[model samples]
Target: MEETRSQVDWLTRAVEALPDEMTFDAMQQLILSMVFLRQVSDVPEGEAQGRPTWEELVGQVAGKPDLVHQPVQRALRAWSGSYGKFRIDLDNEAVLGQMRSDSRVVDRALRDLIALLDRAGRAGAKGDLYDQCLARFSEDRVGGDYYTPRDVVRTMVGLMAPAPGDEVYDPACGSAGLLTEAARYVETHGGRPADRTGPVLRLFGQDINARTRSIAAMNLILHGLEDTLPRDIGTDNSLLHGSDAGEKYSVVLANPPFSMRMPLTDAGFVFWRYGPPPKSKADLAWVQHVLGALKADGRAAILLPNGAAFRGGAERRIRAGLLYDDVVAAVIQLPSGLFSHTRVPACLWVFSKSKRAHAATRVLFINAQDTGVQVSRGRRTLTGADAERIASTFNSWSKHDAADVPGWCRTVALEEVEAADFDLQPARYVAPVAAETAPGEDERRVRELTEELYEHFAEASRLEHELRDVLGT
Candidate 1:
């Protein structure tokens, strides 16, 4: 506990010391250097481990037993040379002046420090220490941006319920969060954590960004999956390399980037069979990729933008093909602003390769757009209760009872789906419950007109305020 607390304090200090204009890479280097300084030092006998003096530790590494106050000078010089930068005397005011003039030197030093620490971490020297360093990195860098919250990850994993012997994969594994959650689920279900090896050996991921791949590897290691057998496979530019084809998985979970465009050639010709998706939207292509990667008994849960459900043209054809296969099991509509980066409402498309007794020819539609609570201004999240409600709804659907909760969830037949031009938008089919009737139509019309007039008055007032501000009133 002392070591953990010390490491945390060191990380906090290092991050705090970084320049405000520091690039992400530079911040990474600074954090890595601090981690190394905290972990890779010799301990004196009979000394308490809590809060060892940095000066004493640096002096021991430099072999200058008598130069306690001068340890920073030697440490600076040693780190400079290791990072491929010119050495400087920390105690020399003139040298420090010269060092501050060259920005390239600082960048090089930072890069070297990070590279050295990354190499050491991957070399099996101190796995737990390395993971703590990575946790700090994730906290500082990712925070709540572009990555799912940890609680949401846990909820998704619970709903998926990957068994110890199940093969799990995430095609767009951002930071490998889903993979780690799946591993945790296996352990909590009475399976030995080490059993995450052979069955977990089937873990795979692909990302288009190199830095994200590194983050994924670090995340997996931090989650006690460092020793899992068959090793996790991850690669950057995976789609471009065409490496994920012909591979299948027992379970897949992903939140792919929304509405991004990809060339048909880049996705390979095989996706064309589902009918070519529009060039400007690659949502259907991603759907096809997930479908192709699923084994005969596989299941998938994918997050998609609102456009994927009711879009016309090629996307409609792809939707039709999926329905034809009876692979779609459920569609859960999520609230807008649930993602940190975008305000576009999203949905979860759940698919199963083989139809269970309750899932045959029936699609469970959940209108959860109003389910989550607000986490920040204009941002919302599904609490544990909300997730449980949705999961229970799904569980009920899987048990063959048509869950017919008005305005919340319902089971749609394939015939109705075909009648709607294969549109999968949840709101189109599920009707909301009725409220008590008003006294008369004329009274209701007067009330509606009064509300419209108030809206116009409010808009006029807002415009007047804006004009006054612009005129410096």
Candidate 2:
């Protein structure tokens, strides 16, 4: 955690060092791209026979800054395949040409950042280091779109409980954080963390933006222990009106873009597993897309906007089909500000093709809107203990007939669900704590009820007389 904070602080210093035209996104791409090359290459950056590696070349520029253009250009050409579509200002910077005739500013910034990374590396903070960079990089940016706070990712990953040889995927994997955590899950479960040639783990991801995809690839190359598996992060939209790929996985964990509106490019897409979603609001569409992509007996935990829970019309129909199919396993109401991108409430919908442990006729409802500790004005995050508490509740409930905690969680039968129009709002089923009655409270309640009933009877007589006059009786 301190490493991440330090990285964020240094990233701010790096951004302040650059020209106004440079964006945090652009700066991040350049730095991480270099970091990726340094990590993936077998040879450390060095002064090798006439062709020094990029890091060695950067070091050579400290004093004689005017001569950096040629070596840096060579490095870009050498590693172009690895960095693909970075949209970086320099492909690499030519000191004299684009550095406004002063190369030291760029040189000093890169030197300092890389130095910090080297120290962190020896300090054992090398795993997924750029997650910190990306999180901090988005802080001042207009929208904190790709920042899926790490704790949320960790909790979601814990809930999925992926095992060795289990195929894991994320449809809208920003920076591939979910995939990174899933890889960790495999390692923790007595499986290899990474296998370059014959990996026991399979990682798949798709993001609509090519730039983010490239960034994700670079991020994965460095930290995820990805040297073992063939990475399959793609640039195409996974919800492409049809099968994104005929691929399915053992586990599907995703927090897809919510309330997205794109034209239905595949009108005959045949999303009948759940049902086709409206074009204007694609929340259920992504949900259906994920559901359809799951193999029989597969399990998934999806993050969704609260509207997907109880919205009327087409969404209502979708909810009915999910419940009827018995694939809707649990609904967890997350706290507000869990996401820094939008203040809209969030929830988790866990689906299982075959629920062998819990009864299919009933689903778990956990109202955790009060779970997180506020960290900022409009943001909050679940600490390790906080997440464990929430996760333990669901885990115990799923694996055994765990006693329900009043006012927090409840198991609602399908009949009750149907009575509520299949509404998934957690509060609808999980009642709040009822205050205990004081002494003599029962007599007070009876007296209040008798007086109220008599007043209602008198009003009924007056209404009857008014109706008779209106009917000319």
Candidate 3:
């Protein structure tokens, strides 16, 4: 999918043919319908488990066009927080309502989409189909947080290094990129990425938005994660209404909203594993959530705003608590413009429930803010080299043979962090660099140096004359 231009694929073209303003909800549901149809087509007839097959729907369409929505409606059984049981409203003229008016055009579009799916097969190998579906959503209908840059996601996944039989989760899984990367990690470690059944691997997610929740679930489906389709993901507020309360996971990766000042009403909520955050920002609240959700040995990588580290009062308490418990593993400051919507830069905070065995005495701090290249006019991203460098630095420190680089990375002892009042900011821990001057600063410096030398010579001559007078020469 060439994202630089509108794709000519049948999915994009068919979606473009939808009627009216083409809302976000409608587009997500429509894509879900297509994905469901594809999944149904792939399963064996006897093993469909009461799901409808795409060929069956096509057969009904061939017989009577008036009953276009009937077959799909019947095939779609309502599940909790899913497309309503008994039927999905596919014929309300909002999305497919124009099907009644321009039946021929709509039929042609649907058939073209089906033909395209058949030619390419139903399930994508890895992130292929999910990426295409996201590309389609990128046209005009996605409403949520900025998508995590692919390289950043890759780097985070590498740092966590999820293993086989690990249970991976992302709480604010806007696009499910973190879990997708986790799935990839499982495959790299001699496991299956598409294995949805238990014991091998498990992927979990929770989102506040209903539409984005649906999109996340469908994204997993397209990525060939069929067993993870109807797992623990739900459309509920992770801060207020939490999920997976007592179930700790093996790996957790997340990019929660930075400034969603969670209301302070939940001082008694069960989600407050590290107590409650301030009434202003939810940054540390998300941190506490991740920390609490981790199994005793689980490791997590979180992308958070810079404020969460050094903010005073309530945030300071959270930081101090984490440091005291020795769960704060490492912090990596990222480059600016990683997210286009906001100007605030972000950093990666890695936490391990049991760090005493590995990085027991010190917390690794990496300053990678200057390593990214400006790929676009305003967006700065980490190149493959940059990612490798950062990830390597983390691994080196984790293994206790870290090579310290000035202005790049530094390891500080836990006692030092406690002395600094638990300031987890990378700038506080990393070494400083000498001030760098601009192009013309050297010329001005040279001139100033010459003038100072002439003045010193004059003063020396005056001193010589005074000495001659004293000697009566």
Candidate 4:
């Protein structure tokens, strides 16, 4: 791991050394594109025998400095056909033209990147390099919607418990984090290996940002999932556009952009059957989309702002519809500051198409708002133990063994939820653990408090009587 970090750091420095004219977005694309091109060109020894490697191209650039941009562009375009096309503009001479004066710097950066990858060798296929690059860049970017923290993704994946042969989908798959985490979770739990030999689970994702969608493709490729069809991981607006109505998956995981306002005109009315979400807020719109995209027995996990749990009007109607359907399985309220971009408290809404007989009429509420440990000034994450605790509580409930733990988790029947007017905030229902007291200790404490109060009352009366006598008429 240290070695990988060292490599990433060196490559990051190379990117940093570029001319000032290059934007962060351009620089990011340049670095990732180069890394991806190198990985693709490295088609093993004796394979793709005639194809020029990134190393050979860079070596030739030293002799013919003027030809620096063309060869690399051609190479990337050539390799893109076999892998996937990058969405950024490589032909934009305005950016590439600016490098003419700093050709040597560009050449050195490319060479250094190639050397780093050469040292990385076959391990580059594992994607740690790319993952770290995306993370490092994302940390400094403004709105961090493009990257979901790995720990959060892990917790969601752990709770969902996807298995082999299950079709998995992420509607707002920023950099494909959720899908990759799900793949990793399956591998960790003794399912099929996440290799090129056809992944055990069929993974699918869609992102609206073309550049981000491209990044998702590279992410999947590096994780030994290059064989996934292009159509499966697309750039369509998932809310308004999706697979045919008959198409659905057994597992879905998503962390869509929060509080985004977009036109709902393109979306089918079927998705809004329960109610149309307000144009100013699309949180519940995303919820209904996920619910509609599930198979008959599908299970899903979604990360949304806390407001979705108790918002009024149309949102409440949707919540009621979901409850009546008995599909809302669990709502685990997460800690605040879990995201760097926003401090809006978030929660995980787990849905099940077919619930067990014991849990069908009930919904599990886990008040984990106080569960995580602070990792930095304003960021917190769930430790493995934290994640396990949440998952175990849900597991226990699924097996009909759930017992309410004050201030933590509770199992509420449909009737109780209705009585509460469909308020799903776990804190409103899960009581805090009462303070422990010894036998008869409560009575003794109350008696002592009562005597103290009586003494104060007597003092007040005596003072009033003395004042009245002094002012007597």
Cα-based TM-score, every candidate:
0.69, 0.81, 0.74, 0.81
Summarize candidate 2's per-residue lDDT along 1-473 as a digit string, tens digits. Answer: 43446545655665565555555556666666655544443255352334456456547655555454455556655655533323222255533234444566555555565555454444343554566667766656646555577878878888777776677878888878788888877777767765544547777777877767766676666654454334456566777743346677888888887788955586556665666677788888888878877889788888889998988988899999888988888898888877756768988888888775566678989888777787765578888876677677777777775777888888888999999998998988887676788999999869866976686699689989999999999
For candidate 4, lDDT tens digit of each residue in 78-120?
Answer: 6654454333333334455555476676666555555565565
lDDT of each: 0.63, 0.70, 0.69, 0.75
Clashing residue pairs for model 1: none
Better of 1 and 4 by lDDT: 4
1-473 per-residue lDDT for model 1 (tens digits): 01345445545644554455556665664354444443433234334244333445543534633332234344433433211111211122223233334544444443343334433344333434545555556545524332565545655666677776676777788767777767767877767545524544346667666656655655554444655524444553433433354467888887777887875566434535477678899877777777777788888888888899999998998999899889998888887756655557888888888878777887889888777787545556677788878767876676656648899888998999999999899988776565666679768768866976686699689989999999999
Report clashes for each candidate as comma-separated counts: 0, 2, 3, 0
Candidate of highest lDDT: 4
Error of 2 at 233 (Å): 1.9
- Those runs of model 1 whose alpha carbons end farther than 4 Å from true positions after fitting are 1-15, 28-146, 196-201, 229-232, 236-245, 431-473
Can you give the lDDT of residue 179 in candidate 2? 85
Q: How close is candidate 3 to the true structure, as a TM-score?
A: 0.74
Worst 10 residues of 4 by lDDT: 84-93
Across residues 1-473, which tens digit of lDDT does each residue of candidate 3 receive? 12333232656565665554546566556655665555535656676656556666566666755444555445544211233211222232456553436556556555555555554444445346556666445434322373576778888988987766777888898878778778777787788865546456777787877656656665665566646433546555667655544567888899898878786567445756565788889998888888778888889999999988888898888887788788888999888766655658788999988775657867899988777787654457778788878887887778665777899998888899889988888988785586789999999868866976686699689989999999987
Error of model 2, residue 289, in angstroms: 0.6
